[model samples]
Target: MDLIAKNLSYKPTDQFHLNDVSFNFKNGNLYTILGRTLSGKTTLLKTIAGLLTPDSGEIDFDGKDFLRTPVWERNVAMVYQQFINYPHLNVFENVAFPLKQRKMETNVINEKVIDALKSVGLSGYENRKIQELSGGQQQRVSLARSLVKNAKILLLDEPLVNLDYKLREQLREEFKNLFSKGLADETILIYSTTDPRETMELNGEVIVLDEGKVLQVGPAKEIFENPNSLKVAEISNDPPMNIINAEILESEVSFEGISINAPKHFNNINNKSFKIGLRSSDIILNEKGYEFEVELAEISGSETLLHLKKGNTKLIMSIEEVMNFKIHDKVKINFKIEKAYAFNSNGDLASSPFRSKNG
Candidate 1:
């Protein structure tokens, strides 16, 4: 059965939290809602879970009206970013809470809780107290609790967001393993995250949200490579794509007084002013290129992100190695003309490097 949400809108105040959102979520598929804070990712999830009602929308699940159903009867499970568990109850009891609330048989509850715990790699942590476990383990407990329900719809709202970096990486791999191994074969899983990297790692159907609106939805890679608009490109990218105003004249593209031979991807387009979108990785350091002063340099992990400026243009380049550079340091950089994306003046994508034709 598929879950269909049509024209969902919820405006509690002056702004719309879910502005005309609509999508069909199929079973046995993982969908990621990618957005920043207050982008309505949580609002959409809560509305689907029946935790919050929308001001206007139609929710259909298995050919029935889902919005009409009570939250307790919706047969959905949600795992929050924070570790949520009963402080007085141990792992076993915490996971068994849902089944107990349903007054399920003792034997069935025991079997289900054990299976859920095993699925989350916490098979032996049943008797451990909540306070006695680490943050990751506690999250596992929360995950096991959600998994125990075996709900038709499973919503994970940034479940690993609070964990340490190494732990988050470990759990992310584990999650991919779990989801790919048919553990949720009968459920529709919806995960939300602000991390573009995390969304790419999951490699699922991606729904890009921005300011309470659904900007674009497609395969994670497609959305990454061919963001429909400027907003989608910015939100779907980790460091946000660098945008620069440029003009196309015959076979050349000019920006900030610098001109380069336009790639074949933009050949069909008319000579006009367009916005160029380039990923940080697409810009490279070259000794024979234009000189730009370093505005800022940030070291993250094993790479260095250099922010540079030349004339009126600014760009960020992602260097593969861990290098040190000071502010105002002069560096020569070149654009990978073949990897540039062209956006119309209205911010809609006019051409992409991955696409053969221009709009």
Candidate 2:
């Protein structure tokens, strides 16, 4: 079974919530919708779940017209970013709600509920009340509820987004394990998140959205290594990929007052002005490198992100370890030229180091 959306467009007002979005989602694959807030990730998921009607589009599932189907009959389950559960119901009741609604026998409901709870590591907490559980546990209950249905379409809209960082990380790992074990092999799993790292961890097919428009779609590694455009690179990265104005002249790539030999990937290209893209991790502190002033230093977990500036160029450097640095501190840094990317003046990717030379 496959879910095919053709030219989906939803515009309640003047802004297009989903602008000409189209994709063929195959069964049994996990697809991550990665974008910033207000980027139509949630809107797209809601549309698929039959929660939002697109202004103009055709949805077909398993060769049947999906848009004409009512939300209740879609057999699609969605877990929202916020924990959604019936406060009056216990964990078991919440998980069994869908099966019970179908008027299944008690034995089948009990069996399915227990298995779903066990899959999400809440086997012994079946008797616990919704209010008694922590945020992570509550979210697990929501997931268990969806799992019990065994629906053909499973949509998770930032399900782990409201939890603490540590708990989010923990649940992310569990999600990977659960999905990797064929738990929902017959289901189409579509997860939406604004976190690039989370998308990277999932390591699934990625759809990069921005402002209600589709930017790029590919494997997570492909999108990460070779973003189709400048916006894709920025949205696919946490601190955003560092971009600087540069050009190729003769056999050298020059930017600001610095110049480096053009990478072989850019060989045979005509001399012209373009833009250079560099990941934060590709720029490192080097004593014998170009000088830049530290504008801001942020410490996140075990790493340090240093925002440096020199003349008209500014860059963010991701250091592997934590290091303290004050603003206005002079630091020399070097770029990993081989790991750099090139984009045309119009913001389209021209060359990627990950590809073969001149590819």
Candidate 3:
């Protein structure tokens, strides 16, 4: 089912859970909600599930107000961070509970329950009690329950938070594969996470929320490479966009005691005082480029992160090659002039003819 929320805001204790959040969730797409704890990620998911109503907004499901419909008729299933199941009930009973509630035929329930368990890789363990299962198994059981319900909208609120690192990675793929089963006409997966890997695995549109405010919502590539505002730029995990103060003269840009030849487009900025952003991948350790001292180096397997300081300004750059410098090592940094972003004093990004805004 396609869901559309407009002007969604909720105020419980003078503090809002959502701040005029608006987005149209496509029918058959895996959508992820990314934010910190108090950023209203869970609250937004709950609002969609009909657990809590927005103080001022409307949720439309195919031109009908979801709020006006009864909660039971919303056709939405929610799987939270906790793996909740009937501890006394066996896996089969737990998986078949929703089907029994709907009073489906015995043969049909058996077919659907077995299908769900098989999708979660728990086909032969149906008679085992939930308490006898591992954390991952129990979480899979929870997922199975949601899947067996045949709900259109799947609200997963940090469902893999309790699993260990390895299991978390493993289950992430299993859950994603569940979407291909074709159970519903359209399944909209609303996953909430602060982990970048989860968002990376899903590889869909990402909505970054900060303290109950909607920072930005767009495809992952556009949001990462061409953020329209500073708030969105601050939450990027791939080396938060490089920002440095720079001044544009008649035909030159001066920064960090280095002046580079500026293009004619530099003179057309709407504002004077602006900051320039450079991606980590764009800068290199070229001897003929700008010079600086490497203050810190963080090694993360294949790629190395270098924290370089130019005078009092510090910048982060990532290199695919192995780290060759130690702490306090002086290195000359070079960057491609074509791969930079200029933003005005208001933090609004400046247009670059060389770079598309939707990159």
TM-score versus the correct structure, for each prediction: 0.97, 0.97, 0.83
Please list the C-alpha lDDT of all candidates, in the order they appear: 0.93, 0.91, 0.81
Candidate 3, residues 199-290, lDDT tens digits: the string is 76777788888878877788777666666766566565567667888886656677878887765445565326567777788788888888
Using lDDT, give the best candidate's number.
1
lDDT of 1: 0.93
**Model 2 lDDT per residue over 39-86, tens place:** 999999999988889999899999889999999888899999999999
Name model 3 segments beyond 4 Å from true: 127-135, 161-166, 180-184, 250-252, 261-271, 294-296, 321-327, 352-359
Regions more than 4 Å wrong, model 1 = 356-359
Q: Any runs in candidate 2 off by more than 4 Å, and if so which?
A: 356-359
Q: Which residue pairs clash in candidate 1?
A: none
Sequence-dependent TM-score of model 1: 0.97
Q: Rank the candidates by lDDT, best first.
A: 1, 2, 3
Give the per-residue lDDT digits (tens) of candidate 1, residues 1-359: 99999999999999999999999999999999999999999999999999899999899999989999898888899999999999999999999999999999999999999999998899888899999999999999988899889899999999999999889999999999999999778999999999999999999999999889999999999999999999998988878899988898988999877889998899877678888999999999999998899999999888899999988888889999999999999999999989999999788999998985465
lDDT of predicted model 3: 0.81
